[model samples]
Target: MEKFSFDGPPVGDDADISAECQRQLLSPIQEIVKAAVAAGWSRQDVLLAMVELSWDMYEKRRGDL
Candidate 1:
């Protein structure tokens, strides 16, 4: 698989920050997911765990912001 890369928003461009952030994050995230699957972890389980952990983190951190 090719490594993901993002050039980022152009100078003075008002790109969607959330989308840009996701693009930047995808490369490492994909690497981790692929590695986890290769190491005998089922994709469904890994994805479900990610969703559960992410939701928990979001809920915990929501109060801070």
Candidate 2:
């Protein structure tokens, strides 16, 4: 497993730019997802795993430690 931080445009400035930044950040994930599927993991399984991992990151960002 690998951990990384994604820092993008600040919150609540411009919606279009914010959305575009999000799209760019998430774009690379598609290739990794395809690789995961090729490695025999179901799409749903991979999605769920990502969701769980995102929640952990969210919690930590929220200072839940």
Per-candidate TM vs. native?
0.71, 0.66
Model 1 spans > 4 angstroms off: 1-13
Query: Cα RMSD to native, each candidate?
Result: 4.6, 4.0
The 0-to-1 C-alpha lDDT of every candidate, in the order given, reads 0.83, 0.78
The prediction achieving the highest TM-score against the true structure is 1
lDDT of 1 by residue, 4-27 (tens): 667766355675877878778877
- For model 2, state the Cα shift of residue 56 in Å: 0.7
Model 1 RMSD to the real structure? Answer: 4.6
Reference-based TM-score, model 2: 0.66
- In candidate 2, residue 46 scores what lDDT? 91
* lDDT, candidate 1, at 6: 72
Error of 2 at 63 (Å): 1.0
Ten-residue segment with the worst summed lDDT in candidate 1?
Answer: 3-12
